[model samples]
Target: MSPPSGATTTFLLIEHRREIADLNERIRNRRLQVLSLYGTPIVVVLTLLVWAGLKIFIWLSSDTPTAINAIFFSVAVLLAVAAGAQFYAEFTATVWKDAETPVRELRLELSLADERHILEARRHTPPPTDRQASYKERLPQELVRLRIESRHYRRMHLMMQWLLFVSSAAISAVTAWYDPPQPAKGVLIGLGFTITVITAAAGYFKPRERAFNLQQTADSIEQHATALELGISPYNASEEKQNLELFATTVEGMRAEQRMREQQLDQPQQGQQQVI
Candidate 1:
Protein backbone atom coordinates (compact mmCIF):
# COMPACT_ATOMS: atom_id res chain seq x y z
CA MET A 1 0.00 0.00 0.00
CA SER A 2 1.16 3.52 -0.78
CA PRO A 3 1.87 5.97 1.99
CA PRO A 4 -0.45 8.97 2.30
CA SER A 5 0.65 12.13 0.42
CA GLY A 6 1.73 15.18 2.47
CA ALA A 7 -1.30 17.19 1.35
CA THR A 8 -3.70 14.38 2.24
CA THR A 9 -2.17 14.05 5.72
CA THR A 10 -2.35 17.82 6.25
CA PHE A 11 -6.02 17.92 5.18
CA LEU A 12 -6.91 15.07 7.53
CA LEU A 13 -5.08 16.80 10.37
CA ILE A 14 -6.99 20.03 9.78
CA GLU A 15 -10.31 18.22 9.67
CA HIS A 16 -9.60 16.36 12.93
CA ARG A 17 -8.41 19.56 14.59
CA ARG A 18 -11.62 21.33 13.65
CA GLU A 19 -13.75 18.46 14.88
CA ILE A 20 -11.85 18.32 18.20
CA ALA A 21 -12.19 22.10 18.65
CA ASP A 22 -15.92 22.01 18.02
CA LEU A 23 -16.42 19.06 20.38
CA ASN A 24 -14.36 20.76 23.06
CA GLU A 25 -16.45 23.91 22.77
CA ARG A 26 -19.69 21.98 23.00
CA ILE A 27 -18.45 19.98 26.01
CA ARG A 28 -17.36 23.20 27.78
CA ASN A 29 -20.72 24.86 27.16
CA ARG A 30 -22.56 21.81 28.46
CA ARG A 31 -20.42 21.83 31.62
CA LEU A 32 -21.18 25.51 32.19
CA GLN A 33 -24.89 24.89 31.75
CA VAL A 34 -24.82 22.00 34.24
CA LEU A 35 -22.89 24.04 36.79
CA SER A 36 -25.28 26.96 36.51
CA LEU A 37 -28.26 24.68 36.79
CA TYR A 38 -27.03 23.19 40.06
CA GLY A 39 -25.09 26.16 41.43
CA THR A 40 -27.98 28.63 41.50
CA PRO A 41 -30.18 26.25 43.43
CA ILE A 42 -27.42 25.42 45.90
CA VAL A 43 -26.81 29.13 46.59
CA VAL A 44 -30.51 29.70 47.05
CA VAL A 45 -30.80 26.75 49.44
CA LEU A 46 -27.85 27.91 51.54
CA THR A 47 -29.29 31.40 51.75
CA LEU A 48 -32.62 29.97 52.84
CA LEU A 49 -30.89 27.85 55.51
CA VAL A 50 -29.13 30.93 56.93
CA TRP A 51 -32.36 32.86 56.90
CA ALA A 52 -34.17 30.02 58.66
CA GLY A 53 -31.49 29.84 61.33
CA LEU A 54 -31.82 33.57 61.95
CA LYS A 55 -35.61 33.32 62.10
CA ILE A 56 -35.40 30.41 64.55
CA PHE A 57 -33.18 32.51 66.83
CA ILE A 58 -35.62 35.40 66.59
CA TRP A 59 -38.60 33.16 67.36
CA LEU A 60 -36.87 31.77 70.44
CA SER A 61 -35.90 35.21 71.77
CA SER A 62 -39.27 36.95 71.25
CA ASP A 63 -42.86 36.42 70.16
CA THR A 64 -42.78 36.59 66.35
CA PRO A 65 -46.25 37.28 64.84
CA THR A 66 -48.24 34.31 63.40
CA ALA A 67 -48.60 36.09 60.07
CA ILE A 68 -44.86 36.63 59.78
CA ASN A 69 -44.11 32.99 60.64
CA ALA A 70 -46.73 31.79 58.16
CA ILE A 71 -45.30 33.94 55.38
CA PHE A 72 -41.77 32.76 56.08
CA PHE A 73 -42.89 29.12 56.05
CA SER A 74 -44.72 29.60 52.73
CA VAL A 75 -41.70 31.24 51.15
CA ALA A 76 -39.46 28.44 52.35
CA VAL A 77 -41.82 25.86 50.87
CA LEU A 78 -41.90 27.73 47.56
CA LEU A 79 -38.13 27.95 47.44
CA ALA A 80 -37.81 24.22 48.15
CA VAL A 81 -40.24 23.43 45.32
CA ALA A 82 -38.35 25.68 42.94
CA ALA A 83 -35.00 24.12 43.87
CA GLY A 84 -36.43 20.59 43.48
CA ALA A 85 -37.91 21.44 40.08
CA GLN A 86 -34.61 22.83 38.86
CA PHE A 87 -32.83 19.66 40.06
CA TYR A 88 -35.36 17.50 38.24
CA ALA A 89 -34.95 19.49 35.06
CA GLU A 90 -31.19 19.14 35.28
CA PHE A 91 -31.47 15.41 35.86
CA THR A 92 -33.71 14.97 32.84
CA ALA A 93 -31.64 17.20 30.52
CA THR A 94 -29.91 15.42 27.60
CA VAL A 95 -27.45 18.20 26.78
CA TRP A 96 -24.42 15.99 27.44
CA LYS A 97 -25.82 13.16 25.35
CA ASP A 98 -26.63 15.51 22.47
CA ALA A 99 -23.18 17.11 22.56
CA GLU A 100 -21.37 13.75 22.65
CA THR A 101 -23.18 12.35 19.60
CA PRO A 102 -21.35 14.52 17.10
CA VAL A 103 -18.05 13.89 18.85
CA ARG A 104 -18.56 10.14 18.73
CA GLU A 105 -19.44 10.29 15.04
CA LEU A 106 -16.33 12.33 14.29
CA ARG A 107 -14.15 9.94 16.29
CA LEU A 108 -15.57 6.96 14.41
CA GLU A 109 -14.89 8.61 11.05
CA LEU A 110 -11.34 9.51 12.06
CA SER A 111 -10.67 5.99 13.33
CA LEU A 112 -11.90 4.41 10.11
CA ALA A 113 -9.67 6.80 8.15
CA ASP A 114 -6.68 5.66 10.34
CA GLU A 115 -5.43 9.27 10.36
CA ARG A 116 -6.46 10.02 13.93
CA HIS A 117 -4.70 6.98 15.37
CA ILE A 118 -1.45 7.78 13.53
CA LEU A 119 -1.46 11.43 14.57
CA GLU A 120 -2.20 10.61 18.20
CA ALA A 121 0.46 7.93 18.21
CA ARG A 122 3.06 10.30 16.78
CA ARG A 123 2.18 13.12 19.12
CA HIS A 124 1.89 11.15 22.37
CA THR A 125 3.86 7.90 22.00
CA PRO A 126 7.61 7.48 22.25
CA PRO A 127 9.48 7.00 18.94
CA PRO A 128 8.16 4.03 16.98
CA THR A 129 11.59 2.39 17.00
CA ASP A 130 11.88 2.36 20.82
CA ARG A 131 8.42 1.30 21.99
CA GLN A 132 5.41 -0.58 20.66
CA ALA A 133 2.59 1.66 19.46
CA SER A 134 0.29 0.14 22.09
CA TYR A 135 2.72 0.97 24.91
CA LYS A 136 3.12 4.52 23.62
CA GLU A 137 -0.66 5.00 23.50
CA ARG A 138 -1.04 3.54 26.99
CA LEU A 139 1.50 5.97 28.50
CA PRO A 140 -0.31 9.10 27.33
CA GLN A 141 -3.63 7.64 28.46
CA GLU A 142 -2.17 6.82 31.89
CA LEU A 143 -0.90 10.41 32.18
CA VAL A 144 -4.39 11.71 31.50
CA ARG A 145 -5.91 9.27 34.00
CA LEU A 146 -3.47 10.32 36.71
CA ARG A 147 -4.09 13.99 36.05
CA ILE A 148 -7.84 13.47 36.36
CA GLU A 149 -7.43 11.45 39.54
CA SER A 150 -5.24 14.18 41.02
CA ARG A 151 -7.83 16.84 40.28
CA HIS A 152 -10.67 14.78 41.67
CA TYR A 153 -8.84 14.04 44.90
CA ARG A 154 -7.80 17.70 45.25
CA ARG A 155 -11.39 18.84 44.91
CA MET A 156 -12.58 16.26 47.42
CA HIS A 157 -9.88 17.32 49.87
CA LEU A 158 -10.88 20.96 49.61
CA MET A 159 -14.57 20.14 49.92
CA MET A 160 -14.04 18.04 53.03
CA GLN A 161 -11.91 20.76 54.59
CA TRP A 162 -14.64 23.32 53.98
CA LEU A 163 -17.28 21.02 55.41
CA LEU A 164 -15.20 20.51 58.53
CA PHE A 165 -14.85 24.27 59.00
CA VAL A 166 -18.53 24.95 58.37
CA SER A 167 -19.63 22.19 60.72
CA SER A 168 -17.27 23.43 63.44
CA ALA A 169 -18.54 26.97 63.05
CA ALA A 170 -22.12 25.79 63.25
CA ILE A 171 -21.34 24.00 66.50
CA SER A 172 -19.61 27.06 67.94
CA ALA A 173 -22.43 29.39 66.98
CA VAL A 174 -25.06 27.08 68.47
CA THR A 175 -23.12 26.71 71.72
CA ALA A 176 -22.61 30.49 72.11
CA TRP A 177 -26.18 31.47 71.39
CA TYR A 178 -28.40 28.80 72.98
CA ASP A 179 -28.24 27.39 76.53
CA PRO A 180 -29.66 24.30 78.28
CA PRO A 181 -33.45 23.63 78.03
CA GLN A 182 -33.20 24.73 74.39
CA PRO A 183 -33.10 22.07 71.61
CA ALA A 184 -30.27 23.99 69.93
CA LYS A 185 -27.86 22.89 72.68
CA GLY A 186 -28.42 19.23 71.77
CA VAL A 187 -27.92 20.07 68.12
CA LEU A 188 -24.67 21.80 69.02
CA ILE A 189 -23.40 18.73 70.89
CA GLY A 190 -24.26 16.48 67.95
CA LEU A 191 -22.49 18.83 65.59
CA GLY A 192 -19.43 18.89 67.85
CA PHE A 193 -19.16 15.07 67.83
CA THR A 194 -19.58 14.99 64.05
CA ILE A 195 -16.87 17.61 63.65
CA THR A 196 -14.53 15.63 65.88
CA VAL A 197 -15.00 12.52 63.76
CA ILE A 198 -14.48 14.46 60.56
CA THR A 199 -11.33 16.03 61.93
CA ALA A 200 -9.93 12.66 62.91
CA ALA A 201 -10.73 11.18 59.49
CA ALA A 202 -9.21 14.12 57.67
CA GLY A 203 -6.05 13.89 59.72
CA TYR A 204 -5.69 10.17 59.14
CA PHE A 205 -6.42 10.28 55.40
CA LYS A 206 -4.36 13.41 54.56
CA PRO A 207 -6.10 13.74 51.21
CA ARG A 208 -4.61 17.16 50.53
CA GLU A 209 -1.10 15.77 50.83
CA ARG A 210 -1.98 12.83 48.61
CA ALA A 211 -3.47 15.14 46.00
CA PHE A 212 -0.43 17.41 46.05
CA ASN A 213 1.95 14.50 45.56
CA LEU A 214 -0.14 13.08 42.73
CA GLN A 215 -0.28 16.48 41.06
CA GLN A 216 3.48 16.85 41.32
CA THR A 217 4.09 13.45 39.76
CA ALA A 218 1.68 14.19 36.93
CA ASP A 219 3.34 17.55 36.29
CA SER A 220 6.76 15.87 36.21
CA ILE A 221 5.55 13.34 33.65
CA GLU A 222 4.02 16.07 31.54
CA GLN A 223 7.25 18.13 31.66
CA HIS A 224 9.30 15.12 30.61
CA ALA A 225 6.93 14.34 27.74
CA THR A 226 7.04 17.94 26.53
CA ALA A 227 10.83 18.13 26.83
CA LEU A 228 11.22 14.88 24.90
CA GLU A 229 8.93 16.22 22.15
CA LEU A 230 10.88 19.51 21.85
CA GLY A 231 14.32 17.81 21.98
CA ILE A 232 15.38 20.09 24.82
CA SER A 233 18.12 19.90 27.46
CA PRO A 234 18.48 16.36 28.93
CA TYR A 235 16.62 14.76 26.00
CA ASN A 236 18.49 16.79 23.38
CA ALA A 237 21.94 15.21 23.97
CA SER A 238 20.64 11.71 23.37
CA GLU A 239 19.84 10.04 20.04
CA GLU A 240 16.10 9.86 19.20
CA LYS A 241 15.84 6.14 20.02
CA GLN A 242 17.78 6.55 23.27
CA ASN A 243 15.65 9.52 24.31
CA LEU A 244 12.47 7.58 23.55
CA GLU A 245 13.62 4.66 25.67
CA LEU A 246 14.58 6.97 28.53
CA PHE A 247 11.23 8.75 28.29
CA ALA A 248 9.36 5.46 28.44
CA THR A 249 11.41 4.28 31.43
CA THR A 250 10.92 7.61 33.26
CA VAL A 251 7.16 7.57 32.64
CA GLU A 252 6.92 3.97 33.82
CA GLY A 253 8.73 4.83 37.04
CA MET A 254 6.39 7.73 37.71
CA ARG A 255 3.39 5.53 37.00
CA ALA A 256 4.68 2.92 39.44
CA GLU A 257 5.09 5.56 42.12
CA GLN A 258 1.56 6.80 41.50
CA ARG A 259 0.25 3.25 41.82
CA MET A 260 2.07 2.83 45.13
CA ARG A 261 0.57 6.05 46.44
CA GLU A 262 -2.88 4.88 45.39
CA GLN A 263 -2.34 1.59 47.17
CA GLN A 264 -1.33 3.38 50.36
CA LEU A 265 -4.47 5.46 50.15
CA ASP A 266 -6.55 2.32 49.70
CA GLN A 267 -4.93 0.54 52.65
CA PRO A 268 -7.24 0.05 55.63
CA GLN A 269 -6.65 1.54 59.04
CA GLN A 270 -5.70 -0.81 61.87
CA GLY A 271 -8.45 -3.40 62.55
CA GLN A 272 -10.48 -2.31 59.51
CA GLN A 273 -10.79 -4.63 56.51
CA GLN A 274 -10.14 -2.91 53.19
CA VAL A 275 -13.20 -2.66 50.99
CA ILE A 276 -12.86 -2.85 47.22
Candidate 2:
Protein backbone atom coordinates (compact mmCIF):
# COMPACT_ATOMS: atom_id res chain seq x y z
CA MET A 1 0.00 0.00 0.00
CA SER A 2 1.34 3.45 -0.98
CA PRO A 3 1.70 6.07 1.72
CA PRO A 4 -0.97 8.82 1.64
CA SER A 5 0.07 12.31 0.55
CA GLY A 6 1.13 14.80 3.23
CA ALA A 7 -2.12 16.71 2.92
CA THR A 8 -4.16 13.52 3.27
CA THR A 9 -2.06 12.44 6.26
CA THR A 10 -2.64 15.78 7.98
CA PHE A 11 -6.38 15.52 7.30
CA LEU A 12 -6.43 12.09 8.95
CA LEU A 13 -4.67 13.35 12.09
CA ILE A 14 -6.34 13.01 15.51
CA GLU A 15 -6.49 16.83 15.84
CA HIS A 16 -9.27 17.11 13.26
CA ARG A 17 -11.27 14.39 15.03
CA ARG A 18 -10.85 16.16 18.37
CA GLU A 19 -11.83 19.52 16.88
CA ILE A 20 -14.88 18.05 15.23
CA ALA A 21 -15.95 16.38 18.46
CA ASP A 22 -15.43 19.63 20.38
CA LEU A 23 -17.42 21.60 17.83
CA ASN A 24 -20.23 19.07 18.06
CA GLU A 25 -20.28 19.38 21.83
CA ARG A 26 -20.36 23.18 21.58
CA ILE A 27 -23.21 23.01 19.08
CA ARG A 28 -25.15 20.69 21.36
CA ASN A 29 -24.62 23.03 24.32
CA ARG A 30 -25.76 26.00 22.28
CA ARG A 31 -28.89 24.14 21.23
CA LEU A 32 -29.61 23.24 24.85
CA GLN A 33 -29.20 26.88 25.86
CA VAL A 34 -31.68 27.90 23.20
CA LEU A 35 -34.07 25.18 24.31
CA SER A 36 -33.78 26.32 27.93
CA LEU A 37 -34.50 29.89 26.93
CA TYR A 38 -37.69 28.79 25.21
CA GLY A 39 -38.67 26.24 27.84
CA THR A 40 -38.26 28.33 30.98
CA PRO A 41 -41.15 30.69 30.27
CA ILE A 42 -43.41 27.82 29.27
CA VAL A 43 -42.61 25.96 32.48
CA VAL A 44 -43.27 29.12 34.46
CA VAL A 45 -46.59 29.54 32.66
CA LEU A 46 -47.64 26.01 33.60
CA THR A 47 -46.71 26.65 37.22
CA LEU A 48 -48.67 29.87 37.13
CA LEU A 49 -51.66 27.99 35.82
CA VAL A 50 -51.58 25.60 38.76
CA TRP A 51 -51.06 28.42 41.26
CA ALA A 52 -53.85 30.43 39.68
CA GLY A 53 -56.18 27.47 39.93
CA LEU A 54 -55.42 27.14 43.62
CA LYS A 55 -55.82 30.88 44.15
CA ILE A 56 -59.16 30.83 42.42
CA PHE A 57 -60.37 28.15 44.79
CA ILE A 58 -59.18 30.22 47.77
CA TRP A 59 -60.87 33.35 46.42
CA LEU A 60 -64.09 31.45 45.88
CA SER A 61 -64.05 30.46 49.52
CA SER A 62 -63.56 34.13 50.50
CA ASP A 63 -60.41 33.29 52.50
CA THR A 64 -57.63 35.52 51.14
CA PRO A 65 -54.85 34.71 53.62
CA THR A 66 -51.70 36.85 53.91
CA ALA A 67 -49.44 33.86 53.16
CA ILE A 68 -51.38 33.16 49.96
CA ASN A 69 -51.00 36.79 48.92
CA ALA A 70 -47.24 36.65 49.53
CA ILE A 71 -46.95 33.42 47.57
CA PHE A 72 -48.91 34.92 44.68
CA PHE A 73 -46.62 37.96 44.66
CA SER A 74 -43.55 35.68 44.56
CA VAL A 75 -44.97 33.74 41.63
CA ALA A 76 -45.69 37.00 39.84
CA VAL A 77 -42.10 38.10 40.36
CA LEU A 78 -40.77 34.78 39.11
CA LEU A 79 -42.98 35.06 36.03
CA ALA A 80 -41.67 38.54 35.32
CA VAL A 81 -38.09 37.29 35.58
CA ALA A 82 -38.85 34.41 33.23
CA ALA A 83 -40.44 36.85 30.74
CA GLY A 84 -37.39 39.07 30.91
CA ALA A 85 -35.10 36.12 30.26
CA GLN A 86 -37.18 35.05 27.26
CA PHE A 87 -37.20 38.58 25.86
CA TYR A 88 -33.42 38.84 26.31
CA ALA A 89 -32.95 35.54 24.51
CA GLU A 90 -35.11 36.80 21.65
CA PHE A 91 -33.13 39.98 21.46
CA THR A 92 -29.84 38.07 21.44
CA ALA A 93 -30.89 35.53 18.82
CA THR A 94 -28.76 37.27 16.21
CA VAL A 95 -25.75 37.18 18.52
CA TRP A 96 -26.23 33.49 19.11
CA LYS A 97 -26.53 32.95 15.34
CA ASP A 98 -23.33 34.92 14.72
CA ALA A 99 -21.47 32.85 17.33
CA GLU A 100 -22.76 29.58 15.91
CA THR A 101 -22.15 30.46 12.24
CA PRO A 102 -18.35 30.14 12.27
CA VAL A 103 -18.57 26.96 14.39
CA ARG A 104 -20.95 25.41 11.87
CA GLU A 105 -18.88 26.53 8.89
CA LEU A 106 -15.73 25.11 10.46
CA ARG A 107 -17.49 21.83 11.26
CA LEU A 108 -18.65 21.55 7.66
CA GLU A 109 -15.13 22.19 6.45
CA LEU A 110 -13.68 19.61 8.86
CA SER A 111 -16.38 17.11 7.87
CA LEU A 112 -15.42 17.37 4.20
CA ALA A 113 -11.78 16.96 5.13
CA ASP A 114 -12.72 13.95 7.28
CA GLU A 115 -14.55 12.35 4.34
CA ARG A 116 -11.53 12.88 2.11
CA HIS A 117 -9.33 11.52 4.89
CA ILE A 118 -11.46 8.37 5.16
CA LEU A 119 -11.27 7.86 1.42
CA GLU A 120 -7.51 8.27 1.44
CA ALA A 121 -7.11 6.00 4.45
CA ARG A 122 -9.28 3.35 2.85
CA ARG A 123 -7.24 3.52 -0.35
CA HIS A 124 -4.03 2.85 1.52
CA THR A 125 -5.43 0.24 3.93
CA PRO A 126 -5.93 -3.35 2.83
CA PRO A 127 -9.55 -4.56 2.93
CA PRO A 128 -10.33 -6.91 5.80
CA THR A 129 -10.82 -10.59 4.90
CA ASP A 130 -13.71 -10.70 7.38
CA ARG A 131 -16.58 -8.44 6.13
CA GLN A 132 -18.06 -8.83 9.58
CA ALA A 133 -15.28 -6.67 11.07
CA SER A 134 -17.12 -3.40 10.40
CA TYR A 135 -20.51 -4.84 11.32
CA LYS A 136 -19.18 -6.23 14.57
CA GLU A 137 -17.60 -2.90 15.40
CA ARG A 138 -20.99 -1.19 15.00
CA LEU A 139 -23.12 -3.85 16.68
CA PRO A 140 -22.12 -3.03 20.25
CA GLN A 141 -22.76 0.68 19.74
CA GLU A 142 -26.20 -0.04 18.32
CA LEU A 143 -26.98 -2.39 21.17
CA VAL A 144 -25.97 0.26 23.69
CA ARG A 145 -28.19 2.85 21.98
CA LEU A 146 -31.16 0.48 22.01
CA ARG A 147 -30.67 -0.35 25.67
CA ILE A 148 -30.36 3.33 26.61
CA GLU A 149 -33.58 4.12 24.75
CA SER A 150 -35.27 1.21 26.48
CA ARG A 151 -34.18 2.42 29.91
CA HIS A 152 -35.39 5.96 29.20
CA TYR A 153 -38.87 4.87 28.22
CA ARG A 154 -38.99 2.37 31.06
CA ARG A 155 -38.12 5.03 33.62
CA MET A 156 -40.68 7.46 32.24
CA HIS A 157 -43.38 4.78 32.29
CA LEU A 158 -42.56 3.78 35.86
CA MET A 159 -42.48 7.39 37.09
CA MET A 160 -45.88 8.15 35.58
CA GLN A 161 -47.33 4.91 36.87
CA TRP A 162 -46.05 5.62 40.36
CA LEU A 163 -47.57 9.08 40.28
CA LEU A 164 -50.87 7.64 39.09
CA PHE A 165 -51.06 5.02 41.83
CA VAL A 166 -49.86 7.27 44.65
CA SER A 167 -52.25 10.06 43.71
CA SER A 168 -55.17 7.63 43.52
CA ALA A 169 -54.29 6.12 46.84
CA ALA A 170 -53.96 9.49 48.55
CA ILE A 171 -57.27 10.67 47.12
CA SER A 172 -58.91 7.46 48.23
CA ALA A 173 -57.48 7.70 51.74
CA VAL A 174 -58.62 11.28 52.11
CA THR A 175 -62.10 10.63 50.82
CA ALA A 176 -62.62 7.55 52.97
CA TRP A 177 -62.04 9.53 56.15
CA TYR A 178 -63.83 12.58 57.61
CA ASP A 179 -64.80 15.47 55.33
CA PRO A 180 -61.75 17.48 54.37
CA PRO A 181 -61.15 21.21 54.75
CA GLN A 182 -61.44 23.58 51.77
CA PRO A 183 -57.66 23.74 51.15
CA ALA A 184 -57.38 19.98 51.53
CA LYS A 185 -60.25 19.48 49.11
CA GLY A 186 -58.56 21.78 46.57
CA VAL A 187 -55.33 19.77 46.87
CA LEU A 188 -57.28 16.57 46.39
CA ILE A 189 -58.92 18.00 43.32
CA GLY A 190 -55.49 18.79 41.85
CA LEU A 191 -54.34 15.26 42.68
CA GLY A 192 -57.41 13.83 40.91
CA PHE A 193 -56.64 15.82 37.76
CA THR A 194 -52.98 14.74 37.95
CA ILE A 195 -54.08 11.13 38.07
CA THR A 196 -56.29 11.59 35.01
CA VAL A 197 -53.55 13.27 33.01
CA ILE A 198 -50.96 10.66 33.96
CA THR A 199 -53.32 7.86 33.00
CA ALA A 200 -54.07 9.47 29.65
CA ALA A 201 -50.36 10.02 28.97
CA ALA A 202 -49.55 6.43 29.88
CA GLY A 203 -52.23 5.16 27.50
CA TYR A 204 -51.29 7.45 24.63
CA PHE A 205 -47.51 7.18 24.86
CA LYS A 206 -47.47 3.43 25.62
CA PRO A 207 -44.05 3.81 27.18
CA ARG A 208 -44.15 0.36 28.75
CA GLU A 209 -44.78 -1.24 25.37
CA ARG A 210 -42.04 0.86 23.73
CA ALA A 211 -39.55 -0.09 26.42
CA PHE A 212 -40.44 -3.75 26.12
CA ASN A 213 -39.98 -3.75 22.34
CA LEU A 214 -36.63 -1.92 22.48
CA GLN A 215 -35.26 -4.15 25.26
CA GLN A 216 -36.46 -7.31 23.50
CA THR A 217 -34.86 -6.20 20.24
CA ALA A 218 -31.62 -5.33 21.96
CA ASP A 219 -31.55 -8.65 23.83
CA SER A 220 -32.18 -10.60 20.63
CA ILE A 221 -29.37 -8.79 18.86
CA GLU A 222 -27.01 -9.42 21.78
CA GLN A 223 -27.96 -13.11 21.80
CA HIS A 224 -27.24 -13.36 18.07
CA ALA A 225 -23.91 -11.65 18.59
CA THR A 226 -22.99 -14.18 21.27
CA ALA A 227 -24.22 -17.13 19.19
CA LEU A 228 -22.17 -15.97 16.20
CA GLU A 229 -19.07 -15.71 18.39
CA LEU A 230 -19.68 -19.25 19.70
CA GLY A 231 -20.64 -20.66 16.27
CA ILE A 232 -23.97 -21.99 17.56
CA SER A 233 -26.93 -23.30 15.51
CA PRO A 234 -28.34 -20.96 12.84
CA TYR A 235 -25.00 -19.13 13.04
CA ASN A 236 -23.13 -22.43 12.72
CA ALA A 237 -22.29 -21.98 9.05
CA SER A 238 -18.99 -23.60 8.14
CA GLU A 239 -17.88 -20.43 6.31
CA GLU A 240 -17.04 -17.47 8.52
CA LYS A 241 -18.48 -15.04 5.98
CA GLN A 242 -21.75 -16.94 5.85
CA ASN A 243 -22.13 -16.86 9.62
CA LEU A 244 -21.41 -13.13 9.73
CA GLU A 245 -23.96 -12.56 6.98
CA LEU A 246 -26.55 -14.53 8.91
CA PHE A 247 -25.86 -12.53 12.07
CA ALA A 248 -26.12 -9.23 10.18
CA THR A 249 -29.35 -10.27 8.50
CA THR A 250 -30.93 -11.53 11.70
CA VAL A 251 -29.95 -8.43 13.68
CA GLU A 252 -31.19 -6.06 10.96
CA GLY A 253 -34.46 -7.98 10.70
CA MET A 254 -35.01 -7.55 14.41
CA ARG A 255 -34.34 -3.81 14.15
CA ALA A 256 -36.82 -3.53 11.30
CA GLU A 257 -39.41 -5.47 13.27
CA GLN A 258 -38.96 -3.12 16.21
CA ARG A 259 -39.42 -0.12 13.93
CA MET A 260 -42.59 -1.65 12.54
CA ARG A 261 -43.93 -2.14 16.04
CA GLU A 262 -43.16 1.52 16.87
CA GLN A 263 -45.06 2.60 13.79
CA GLN A 264 -47.93 0.33 14.74
CA LEU A 265 -48.08 1.99 18.15
CA ASP A 266 -48.21 5.39 16.48
CA GLN A 267 -50.92 4.32 14.05
CA PRO A 268 -53.69 4.74 16.58
CA GLN A 269 -52.88 8.42 17.09
CA GLN A 270 -52.53 8.93 13.34
CA GLY A 271 -55.86 7.24 12.72
CA GLN A 272 -57.62 9.39 15.28
CA GLN A 273 -56.11 12.53 13.80
CA GLN A 274 -57.16 11.46 10.31
CA VAL A 275 -60.68 10.83 11.48
CA ILE A 276 -60.80 14.17 13.25
Which RMSD values do the candidates have, in order? 9.7, 7.5
lDDT of 1 by residue, 131-166 (tens): 543365566776787778778878878888898889
TM-score of each: 0.48, 0.63
Candidate lDDT (C-alpha), each: 0.69, 0.77
TM-score of 2: 0.63
Q: Lowest lDDT 10-mer window, candidate 2?
A: 94-103
User: Candidate 2, clashing residue pairs?
Assistant: none
What would the per-residue lDDT of candidate 2 be over residues 1-276, giving only the tens digit for each residue?
A: 766675565556556577667667766766666676667778777877876787686576776678877886787788779767656655655545424344466567668767865776666563443446667778999999999999999999999989988999988887767465555787788998999899888888999999999999999898888988888998887888788777777887898988888877776877746644
List candidate 2 stretches off by more than 4 Å.
1-19, 30-131, 180-183, 269-276
Which residue runs of candidate 1 sit more than 4 Å off their true CA positions?
A: 1-138, 268-276
